[model samples]
Target: MPDADNYGNPDYPAQLAEMARVLQLHRGPIAIASHVDADGDAVGSVLGLQRALRALGKPAQAFLRVPNYLAFLPEAGEVSPPRAQLEPGTLLVVLDVDSSDPLRVEGVAIPSGAELVLNLDHHGTNSRRADLSIVEPGKAATCQLVKELVDSLGVPWTADIATPVLLGLVTDTGSFRFMNTNGAVLRCAAELVEWGASLSWINNHLSQQPKSHYALLVSVLSSMEFHFSDLVVSAQINQAMLDSAGAGWEEAEAFVNTIRSAQGTELAVLFKDYGDNVKISLRSRGRVSAQAIAVACGGGGHHAAAGATLNLPYLEARATVLGKIEEQLQIDGLR
Candidate 1:
């Protein structure tokens, strides 16, 4: 665990070390289940750990439940769902996912005597339900923790590992432009780069991937609607809008964050009717806790980014969410 030892000495608790020790015992086979979005952080992390697991001579596989069309990541062609040959006592390592949404764990049917459910993530709202949960909400990305966590397997960090790991760190930090970029993040970035992870290469794949064919950004901006007297900027995308663009739900993801990007905007909500129920995403660039808002609306996310699904129509969900935000603003003022 020398590589693990280097990142956080006394800062990392002994419990995390113990959790890593438990993961090492599953030497035969492992199943790595992760979110399907394959966002930079998610995909990069899956790749990093998958590469590492193979290097350790451990039979490992990466599984994604979602379809590939909506997941337009850089290495989408390379990632396929894992095979179903996982042994009865296989180790299940769940990464970058919060247990608040356990329904995502479908009928993989792990044995009752499964060795370990390694939950590794950096989300503040994590469930801590893993046999070993190493949650450092302060860290930039789960991929950062993943790199450190696998070091306990006695594997050294290399170019193969650093490339994918960098995807998570770079994107999660908003290309190192966000407030979360602290000394630890910078140090990890430097180390990963020195090991042959190219920042420009990663950014080019994500940031500079010509948006020419897609005019969804323009269409979204044209219809961008603001509420709360412009303090809150909101947007909604119906199925018709998706048809107009060459994209779908994932393209609309940038809307909520776009609202938060505006000057003087404090709250942003992006409503998308994704069948049966409407999916609501909340983003707050100010001191407000978007997580609390989402929890109120039956969703969960971090303080800045939160989401939930509402049974009501688009307008009702909007009013309900806005009312709650207003209530919080008043209560905050009363203090």
Candidate 2:
């Protein structure tokens, strides 16, 4: 029960093992720094790990770099940004994120001399900036990975613990609807539900079922254009869409998903004009790795979904992003 041996399969990557080593090395204070506005995946990872670390008598604190969607989860009151820098005996553990500049914590900073117990993500575009980076692209969600860690820790996976992680799993998998979702993900999500993760509540928050919620969708649909024999679909939005929907930048993060939701779109792109540059959002179905398309433009994410923000003028930036997608289309023989 000490390590992953206590859990179902201990899906412990070499990264988790390295985390234990760093814990032992410090054996005193440890800090868990994570992003806030934390979806189920992020909050779950932070909460589960913080609990495990504290159980070991390690001084662990969960830091939120941003405000969470408070209407959604409870990890908020229990969470707050941690003070910058690790204690002399503290080890810093960063989880479930891909940015080195994550948190953009205005006044917060990591101790320049602190040892990092990095739990790097397994995402294809993971930054792997931690001391012990745990990159497990093989796992469907970081929460699933954290659940493995929690199970191996030998403590019961109660609803309080499982709910947060389950939320993350559901969010990341698009409520078990994304193509990345496999039997393993379903099995994991089912277990979380069995462990008391509330699907009804999760669905209420996640599903874009509300008719009023379709404002952004309406905008995307109205602006959408088909290309490449209808295999490629694209849309362009200006700040006007957000103003119309009363959504801020965070709320519009899924703008491209709206475009991709169209039935016949094998590839979908949304170019949101930001004046100086455009935020390029890309999504693809089948074997279309949108991440590759974005990374080609110097951005990255999973194969089907990825994006990049360019500082160039709107038309020029849009041209560059579409050009990359065209290059990919030729490479994939979709053209």
Candidate 3:
């Protein structure tokens, strides 16, 4: 394999080149997949790569259900659900997912019977042993890595491809408001724009939300609780709230970002009741590590943001998660 020449190169450009070289050799169907409850970065990375692969004349398809809010993305209509089985000799490419854990991936199991499995991700915790893995934890978004891969693949940039890749950069950085936004991210955004990415169109679609979303937001906010001199703030959203507001889990997206914006909040936590279990989203500023908190609870994510699902009722899950956050804050000397 040409890629074996520089396997595990510390330099990412070389790593991307190796990935491209390997991908270019495949002459079979390609199926793309990502994490479930797809976010902007996941959706953007999947669509961007899927479109680029097709442009390379490979029979590539994206497998995941697009959330209602993200259905406006370019070529999102082409996305399909996870298949029971893929064509023989298919190259399965999984993106934005940190691990091969079935619970974290979109479908029940990483579809089998592929000629090769390629995993692309930007999470520090990812240790998936795919046939080929391109895991770069420092990347601001997987789309940034995707952009480099697309360039290496010799696929000419188009609005269809650039737009979704830029979407991943924008959303993953909280529209450049989060801690990960840096000069490289800004420069990449500018380059994608030059390639005809529609910034206004992405922003306009991101800005509009339904009335039910706002109603759900109200419930999420009203449930807020402050701890440790207001340095840690927590909130909750349950199925009842969603039903009452005629909303779905998608409507609760970024509610943790909202709570994290509170002044002096070093750590913000949002607990979503999932009947039998509770999903906890964690966001931390400064030296606090959200990833550490999530990992200690059997989940994983980046330093600034992470999540875990506790197999306990809401009350018990809330207490367990809060205890972990408190311990983390104490270690950071913020408690």
Candidate 4:
């Protein structure tokens, strides 16, 4: 069972409270950044934290490479594109990004005179590049930790706050179906619902697919292949397929999930061809550690879900990644 206090860290509450106090004391314009190819957890964490800061009467700006499909999200229009520069002495809060490199913060450059760099994330692979970091790998989602922090600050929860937070919880947990969805996660989700999260609306928007997205899915599915006696399923998507389907990277977000859901499959891999590099997303059942496979490929994430980027052509990258996954399976006696 997971720890009940501090959501796995006894010091988490104090650390979060102190961070909140510091942000409140700064009294300067705050800038928030999250990862590109933003998912519900990323989007929810960024928007929820942005809304919370503003509700506290602090001036905050949220930045993301907002996808057109995500515009339906509340406050989606408010997300700014990454600016080449930031104001000096600004407090920049980066959320749900695995790397501490400023470039990973959706192309936003960290101003030289920035007062503080804070990284809030739930990924175990976080690089700890921020001046202050709160990384709880055991939490179901980063948004869950954000909710705890906001609540500790005595910020009253409203629909605006609860909705996005809940969206993060729902998406990250696979609607409470993933392994990380613990008792505390469920309780937190229950509270969000009590606070007026629109369950149906969030589910509908997240699960509904446009015709173009369906076309992209078909393209990916048509390319699916199985390895290791059907225990490992894989798929690929090239840029041409994306363009032909009139879809963006975000539209392919759920492809790995669809592949992973194959009956009797223990692992799923999606290789996205991005001209210069191939982006790999890995998902697995309990039999394999996706993170370990990713780490071997110089990437990181949780045991069940992880990703990596390889600076190799599609065939070469696929061979290398599949080799790593096969090695892991052999070690675990699955091959």
Clashes of each: 1, 7, 0, 0
The residue-level lDDT of candidate 1 at 279 comes to 79
Tell me the deviation in Å of residue 271 in model 4: 0.8
Q: Name every residue pair that clashes in candidate 2.
A: 37-68, 40-168, 41-168, 120-134, 122-136, 289-303, 290-303
Per-residue C-alpha lDDT of model 3 across residues 138-190, encoded as one tens digit per residue: 67899988998999999999999999999999899989988888777788889
TM-score of each: 0.85, 0.82, 0.95, 0.95
**Which residue pairs show collisions in model 3?**
none
Candidate 4 lDDT over 275-304, as tens digits, reads 888889999888899999999997888999
Worst 10 residues of 3 by lDDT: 1-10
lDDT of 2 by residue, 70-163 (tens): 3456544666555655567556666666536443212126433455546645466676666666667666678877776666555566777777
Q: Which 10 residues in a row give candidate 2 its minimum summed lDDT?
A: 1-10
- How does model 2 fare in lDDT? 0.67
Report residue 45 deviation for candidate 2 (angstroms): 2.5
Q: Considering only N, C-alpha and C atoms within 3 Å, which residue pairs clash in candidate 1?
A: 41-168
Angstrom error of the Cα, residue 57, model 2: value is: 4.9
Worst 10-residue stretch by lDDT in candidate 4? 98-107
Which residue ranges in model 4 land beyond 4 Å of their true spot? 1-8, 110-113
The candidate, 1 or 4, that scores higher on lDDT is: 4
Ranking by lDDT: 3, 4, 1, 2
The parts of candidate 3 lying over 4 Å away from their true place are 1-9
Judging by lDDT, tell me the better candidate of 3 and 4: 3
